[model samples]
Target chain A: MKDVFKPEFVKLELEATTREEVLRELVDLLPVGDDKKELIYQRLLERENLGTTGIGKGIAIPHSRTLALKDVFVIVGRSKKGVDFNALDGKPVHLFFLIVAPPYDPKNRYLITLGKIAEISRELTRKKEWMEIEKKEEFVKFLNGLLREKK
Target chain B: MNKQLLFLISLQELDILIKEKEKEEEMGFPIKPCEELKKAREKIIEKIDAHLMRRYERLSERYGNPVVPVVDGICQGCYMLLPTSLISQKAKNERIHTCPNCGRFLYWVDD
Candidate 1:
C-alpha cells in the first residue's frame, strides 16, 4: 500500500454529537464489510473503555485494530462547535483523526501512522490557524496541504 | 554508582544544605559557608531540574505520560488500541505510529 494520505479520507461537515457517535460514524464510512465492521467497532469501544482518548487542546484521534483489514484507513473529522470529550484539559474537542489497521502485519505500519499523526498534531497544536478553521472543507484542505508539504 | 541511590543522596544533601544555610543566616553569622552551600545547591538543582523538565515535555509529546506501555495493541497512556491501518503501516516502517483515539505517540515495548 502507498504511504500517501489522501483527502478522501477526510470527512467534512461531521454531525456527530458525541465522541462515541463520531467513532461509530467514522467506522461506518470505511470500506470494510459487515463481518469486519463489528470487530472493528468492538475494538474501538474496548480501547475507549480503557481511558479517555482526549489528548487535550481540542483534538482526539480514535483508533482501533482488527484482523479483517488488508490496509490502513484514516478518517478526519472537524466539529466547529466542539464536542465534550472529557479531555484532560476539560475542554471541548474540535478535531479528530480516526485510524484503522489490520492485525498481524509484519512491518508495524501502525507505529508509522502514529508518528505521522504526532508530527502533524504537534504542528497543528502550535499554530493558531488550525483553531480558527471552522469549515470542514478548509480543514481537509489544510490537512492535505500539510501532507503535501511533508514531501 | 546506582542511579537511584545517587538521585536520593543528591536530594537529601540538598535539603540538609538548605536547612543549614537557613540556620546560619538566622544567627547573623558571616554567611560565607551558607553562600557556598547555596551555590552548590543551585548547581545540582539546575541539572536535575532541567533533566526532569525535558523528560516530562517529551513524555507529554509522546504518550502524554512519562512512561507508556502498549498492551495488546492498546496504549496504556490513553488506552486506545491504535488504528489497524496505522499498525500495518508502522509494521512496514513506513511511518511512526500513534493512537488515533488519544493522539499520543505509540511505541511497541517488549516487556
Candidate 2:
C-alpha cells in the first residue's frame, strides 16, 4: 500500500441529488486550479460516458486518468438518503470512491483503486454497514483500516 | 481461473435457484422465488457478467497478451519501476508484493 492517499482528500456528507450530480461534485473535489478544471472535468465526463461507474452493491468507483493533476487523489463520499446511481443492484448508492490520477503514471492506479473498492464493496454489502456509519471520521478510519489490511 | 469466471458461476447458480423458486410459486403458494423475482435476478446476473467480461477482456489486451504478475514491487508484465521498500518487504515474505504503479497482486515466477 502506497501513501498516496491523505485524509484531507476524503470528502464526507456529499449532498449529491442524483448520479450525474454526484459525478460533477466528485470532479469538483479534485485538486486542480481553474486552468485545469475544465480539462479534468471533461476527462472524467468522458470516462463516465464510456460506461456507468456504478459497480452495484450500492457502491460506485468513478475514476479517470488525466494530465490535469500532478499526482493521484481519491475522495470518499456517502449519501445518507441514498442516490439513484443506476446500479445493477437497483439499490440507491450510499458509498462512492472518486479517483483521479496523472496520465503519465506507468501503472493503472485507477484499476487498482477499483479493485480495492470492489474487494471492500462485497464485504460492506454483505454487512450492510454503510448505513451504520454515523460520523465522517469513522468513515475515514474504516478506509484507513482497510488500507492497512495485509495483502 | 480468473475472478470473472467465479462471478459468472455464482450468477448462473443464482439464476437457476431463482427459477426453481418461481416454479414453486406458480403452483398457488408464494415461495422464496417468484416469476417476477426470477426476472429481476436474471437481469442483474446478465449485467454483472457483461460488465466483468468487458473489463477483463479490455484490460487483458491493454496490459499484454497474457496477464503478468506483479512481483517484488515490479510489474513482471512490463518490468516497470516499483518502490524499493515494496520490493524489499516482499522479498522478506513479510507482505504480498503489489505493483506500486499498477496495483496488481504480484506473484513470483521463474523464467
Candidate 3:
C-alpha cells in the first residue's frame, strides 16, 4: 500500500557469497548510524536462524522488527551468482528483500509491506527477466508493476 | 548499558519478532513455531530485575511497546517531545529512561 520500496535501495550487484554476508551487505544500504545498523543486522540474523525466509525459488526475504529503526524500510538486492541461504527448496538465493521495521509500528506498515513483497514474490516465477533488468529504476518499476498486476 | 537494561532491550526485540511472526500467521503465511520464541523470552525475563519486569509488563499493557527509542529527543512510543536535559546526558544509555509524557522506557538511538 505504501511505496516504501525505492530505486536507491535496489542493488544489482551483491558481493556476498554466503547468507550472513548477504544480509550484512543489505543492511549497509540503510541510512542510519553504524550502531543502529549493527543492531538491525543482529536482529535479522536471529530471525534467519529461527527459520529460512527464503520462500524458495531464487528469492530470500530477510526481515525483522527492531528498536534500532524508527520507520519501516525495505531494501532489494540481487546477486549474479546465487548465495546459499538454507532456503526451503535447498536452492541458491539470487534475490534478497530485507525488511526492517520499528518495534512500534502504529499503522502496521511493516506487515503490509511484507505482504506486498510476498505477493510480488509469487509472481516472480513467471517473470524470467527479473534478474536481467539492468537499471535500478527499471528494476524497481518492474517490481512495482508486479504489485499493480495483482489488483 | 547495564546488564538488566541490555537484557530488557534484547527481550523487547524478541517479543517484537514473535509478534511479527504471529501476524504473519494470521495473514495465512506459515511461520516457525512460537514455542522456541517463548523459551527465549523466558530466559531473558529470568535475567531482568523483578521490579523492572513488573514495570515493563504494566507499561506494555498500557502501551503496546513498553520499550522505545528516543530519536532526536522525541519519544517514538507516544511521539511526545522529551526534555532536553535528559537528551543531553553524558551517559544516557547507562541507565534506562522513562518518557515523562507516556512513561515508556526509552533508549537513545543516537548512541
State each model's CA lDDT, in order: 0.57, 0.57, 0.83
Q: What is the TM-score of chain B alone in each candidate?
A: 0.35, 0.32, 0.86
Best by DockQ: 3
Off-target runs (Cα >4 Å) in candidate 3 are B1-3, B26-30
* Order of quality (DockQ): 3, 2, 1
lDDT score at residue B27, model 3, on the 0-100 scale = 46
Pairs that collide, model 3: B1-B94
Which ranges in model 1 have alpha carbons more than 4 Å from their true place? A1-4, A128-141, A148-151, B1-111
Task: Give per-residue CA lDDT, model 3, range A70-98, as digits (tens).
Answer: 78889999998999999888999999999
Taking the tens digit of each residue's C-alpha lDDT, what string does model 3 give over B1-111? 556766888888887777678777654445568898798789889999999999999987887688888887888888888888888887788897789988888888777
Candidate 3, residue A78: Cα displacement in angstroms equals 0.7
TM-score of each: 0.52, 0.53, 0.91
> In what order do the candidates fall by lDDT, top score first?
3, 1, 2
* C-alpha lDDT of residue A36 in model 3: 75
Error of 1 at A22 (Å): 0.7
Which predicted model would earn the best TM-score? 3
Query: Where in model 2 is the C-alpha error above 4 Å?
Result: A3-5, B1-111
**Per-residue alpha-carbon lDDT of candidate 2 for residues A3-120, written as tens digits (9 for 90 to 100):** 4345666556778888778877777766666535655565556455444567677787776655445466788777877888766667888888787765334575655665665566
> Measured against the native two-chain assembly using Cα atoms, what DockQ does each of the candidate structures obtain, in the order listed?
0.02, 0.02, 0.50
Interface Cα root-mean-square deviation for all models: 23.0, 17.3, 2.1
